[model samples]
Target: MTRPPLLEIQDLRTYFYSRAKEAFIRSVDGVSLAIAPGETLGVVGESGSGKSVTALSILGLVGGNPGVITGAVHFAGGNGASGPRNLLADLERYVSLTKHDGRIVAVAKDEPGWRAHVERALARVRGKQIAMIFQNPKSSLNPFVTVGQQISEAVRLHTGVTHASEAKERALGWLERVRMDSPRLRFDQYPDGLSGGMCQRAMIAMALASEPSLLIADEPTTGLDATIQSRIVALLAELKSEFGVTTLLITHDIRVVSRLADTVAVMYGATVMEHGPARDVLAPGVEPKHPYTSALLASLPSTQTNGRRHAVDGRLPVIRGEVVDTMNVPRGCRFHARCDRITDAIRARCMGEEPALATVAAGHRMRCHLHPGEARGG
Candidate 1:
């Protein structure tokens, strides 16, 4: 029997009330993704393109009572697509705690059990099943706590290791696994005591302490020096290979994706315009149908300083008005506002009609009126 996907997310939307704009932000507007076990999926996008929010939404992290998240996020237990291991079915069971006015909203209908379930899921997502190594280790890690304690705390909660001693041992072992020599000494050191690379390694070690099946690393190597960044990404690749773990590598670095991703998903605005095999997504002309993807390929800085660096034209085109509201995202193509293709006559239609995602190739999906397939038939 075939097993279920390691993790599958379908049309996931996460909206947040924007205090600055007084409108809900389409942070994780509509996203669908699937990953096989042991595959590294690279999510590439600009800073505000909703990559991090999508990751947080997956673990139900974004703090909001009425914070609506509508979609499915499923995880498999070393099972292929045919298996019954679906996180969506038991999705609420994996989501973090939700309390409105001190009243628990959903989770088995009971107040206490609901709270317990919420706590458990929070502990699980932040605990075992999924681990997130954030972009900034300094802010994420506590200065007072020893690196070992932080990791040990997670391991102790997620696993059945009752004794603190066992948790510490496991945590130290993880530190060693991340290739931190003399882990025992480093484990007792505070976050501030370690160098940037060591701190990053400690963070990774902490994140993996629970042996999570899925690791969501958000720009894990950003902010670090080039040499350190290279080492960090290498460390993660090694871990992924050795443990047979699935990873969601979130970054805007095309080069990083080239190095680590087995599959690359390009995020433009709140939608995924194009995606496919890692190499295919990076391929020139014949492959990428979206102008955005083509632009991204073109925008990549060339190795040799062939004249002054030139960025994509037109200031990244900030949608020329206000960011679209999640509550009222325009009908057709979400990218049409900033899109240069749609003509004046049909621009209204492109802005008004909703375009569902369609496959142009065997495993590739794109939602655009520009596809030749749509032009030929209809």
Candidate 2:
């Protein structure tokens, strides 16, 4: 049998509840994704399209108290485990059996015994098995501490390098691996002391210091110049190959996804609009099945006139009306309000039934009403 994917997310729903429980902001709604070992999956979308939330949900980092997450995220390669299983599986059984980086761990958004499970899971995997490089190095890095100290801490913690000298040495080695110049000297400098590119490199060093199996890079090139962005992208590509790591790259830059991703998932209005191989779905000549995906590609500068850009008409619909209730989400199609292709007759039908993601071709799927006989409306 073919091995299960390294990670599998099924119908994930993450909603934020108001204090009185009177309202819900459905940040992530029915998002499903899967990634094989050593493969890269790129999630592309505009801001507030639930891309970050999806990543955070996977890591069990979505906030709590007011936030409630309900979903199944199955991860493989945990300790002696042979295949993937839900992280939210029976708490007691999961903790006793699922080991990651030499520790039994269970991480969930919210559940009984969730705190203990999440803390242990994070301690073992956050820096060791699953590393994350955030969008902003400044926010991620501690301004008061020297860069070397931070990197060394993670190296020592995850690798059991008890001696400070050895930890610093490992940190320096990681810095060099990320192609940061003069690694040893840069180690002692604080976050404020390094340039944007250098600081980002330092962040990468810290994240990679533990030799993680999976890396979550959330817009790692967000603030860098085009030149620096290209360098970072190249560096990530190199590291991914060297480490044989599975990567979940979240970004708004279609160019970056096209260049680095093996698979691309286009998300909008808190839902995935299209998913397929990066090369085939993002090819210049091919028209995407989903209107949102097409509009997004058309809006890119390279696809525009002169230096001007193409803009999608109207605005992204307020998902499920403006009520923010999961039960009250728009009557039929959530994206129909902004979809320019909706006809008067089709609009009436679409407004009554939500379209499920249907296969458009081999290895390609899209969520849209105009998919002809493949309509999954109910």
Candidate 3:
């Protein structure tokens, strides 16, 4: 029997208001995604492609004046007993069991009723539902404090361990669990002193101290050597298995996606260009419908391609002319300005008529004007 998904994010839109244009920045546009319980869903895209923003939106984290976010991120918490059940059986019961991670920071825009949902969603992730490890550990960790204290803070918040000493012991155990050598001593070390790999490990430990149900890692291996990157990834994979934690991995590396993702969402600019089981979405097979997906895969370095990397034709189209406004959106596909595979009519549709998400196969979907029939069939 198929297991029910842990989280389903539908029609998420996060726009940032700016004086640069008449509209908001439209950083996240509209995106839909889902992650099954215990499954790793990888989100891949270039910098500024709204990959992390999508993750942020799921947690209701976007903030500040001139920002508008509207979406529903529903969670069917993992059955307390562990294995799977049909989510439809008692979705409300499952939802009632959810807990949000509170420690993850959010940048929220001022909007009506935003505070209530933000607080409610965060309550789930703060210590129970989700935790996040960002791309840059150097900036993420505090230089002045020892790593153990930071972890201890999270442990205390989530677990409410009243005694400082007990928190210390648990924090030490977390370091050891992350495979830090001399964990007890390492606990005394500040973020500035740890090696790149160790800093990431510390960040990972801090994130998991609350025993979160889900983990969102945003390029946690960035700025590290390949070997170090592997170690961090391996460490995250280990913790996920050990704790049965669901993970949402965000990175631009297809190889990383192949390594960690069961399902993949390929995003461009601010929209999901292609999504499916990782293999199918990453396949170089014929009949790949999205031109951008094909181009990304082709661009991967391959010795079989005679050492000549395939460059997607044309430069990445800048939102064009100047930074785009987010307060008000232009009519049509947010991607129309940059898409290469679009027919003239499609381009016309893309520019004037926004397309909704369409399913091409079970568990696979794309958003384009060209696939409306499939949307109905799916």
Candidate 4:
């Protein structure tokens, strides 16, 4: 039987105003995604593709002027009393916008009112129902507090473990569960004392300690040694099997996504270009692929050809153009500028209008002119 999504993001648009450019930086524009219970959904894209912003928007953590102008993050992981709740409930009341040529030119937001409303809407949801392990564990973790204490606090806050001693014991257990060397000794150590890998493990332990229904891991393996990166991925894979926690993993590494994700969403220029089951979407020579997705997969170092590893001949294929600048996104398909598969027949449509995410196969969707006239919906 098919299960409903634990978290669903619909038409999520998070924009930030840049005074120097005097325009809205569309960090996340019209992003829609979903994660079913116990399924890992990996969002892969380049550095500026709005993966992190999408995760932050889900947690109501987007700060700055006119943040999160429009969106509906419907979470179905709440207690039975309330069936499902929109994390961005009543958001329209707090902000007004001025547009010129269909672009947001000015924004007037009641910052205080919006902040209060968001706080109220996410009061019992953020940490308890959806937890996040942010990038850069050293910075995310408190340097002043011991790792154990920090984890204990999260456990107490989310898990209803009121007793400090019990929480501390639970925290220690989690550290051990994450395979921390000398869990007892490491528990009292501050984040600064640990290696990058160890710190990441601590961060993971703390996030999992709360047993949140949905876990958002933003760039979980970034800024670590290659060996450590593999270990962290391995650990995460193990934990996913053990805990079966629904996760939204945001990263640029396709290898990591291939290993961990059941479904994949390929984002570019602040929007999803392709989304589907990982096996089909990441398969080499897969048909009906968006040009951006094909380019990304082609850039990989090596691939198995006929069940044997072969290095790509000559230099690796590089996407010819620079990453899309979200500040001044083009009129047509966001990827049309960099796309290499634009035939003369589709060139006009690719340059004139953005294609909707159209279903091209069972459980697969693509946003490209190549797959024209399919059902227009994610």
Each prediction's TM-score against the native? 0.79, 0.83, 0.78, 0.95
What would the TM-score be for candidate 1 when compared with the true structure?
Answer: 0.79
Task: After the best TM-score superposition of candidate 1, give how far the Cα of residue 54 lies from its true spot, in angstroms.
Answer: 1.2
Quick one: ranking by lDDT, best first? 4, 2, 1, 3
Q: How many clashes (backbone N, Cα, C below 3 Å) per candidate? A: 9, 1, 29, 0
Worst-scoring 10-residue span by lDDT in model 2:
318-327
Encode model 3's per-residue lDDT on 123-159: one tens digit a residue: 6454455788888787789999999999999888887
The predictions' CA RMSDs to the true structure, in order, are: 6.2, 7.0, 7.5, 2.4
Candidate 4 lDDT tens digits, 1-378: 078889889989889887874888899989998888899999999989999999999888989588898889989996755666888988889978787877667778887899888888888887788989977888889999999999998899999899999999999999998999999999999999999999999999999898899999999999889999999999999999998999999999998998999999999999998888887788644542678887887777765442222235667778888999999898899999889899899888888898998777777878888876354332
| Cα distance off (Å), candidate 3, residue 374 | 2.9
| TM-score, candidate number 4 | 0.95
Displacement of the residue 376 alpha carbon in candidate 2, Å: 12
- Which stretches of model 1 miss by more than 4 angstroms? 1-3, 20-22, 78-117, 120-125, 163-166, 283-287, 304-331, 341-349, 372-378
- Runs off by more than 4 Å, candidate 3: 78-113, 283-288, 303-332, 336-338, 343-352, 369-378
Number of colliding residue pairs in model 1 = 9
| Cα lDDT over the full model 4 | 0.87
TM-score of model 3 (CA atoms): 0.78
Residue 270 in candidate 4, Cα distance off native in Å: 0.6
Comparing 2 with 4 on TM-score, the higher-scoring candidate is 4
Q: On a 0 to 100 scale, what is the lDDT of residue 25 in model 2?
A: 63
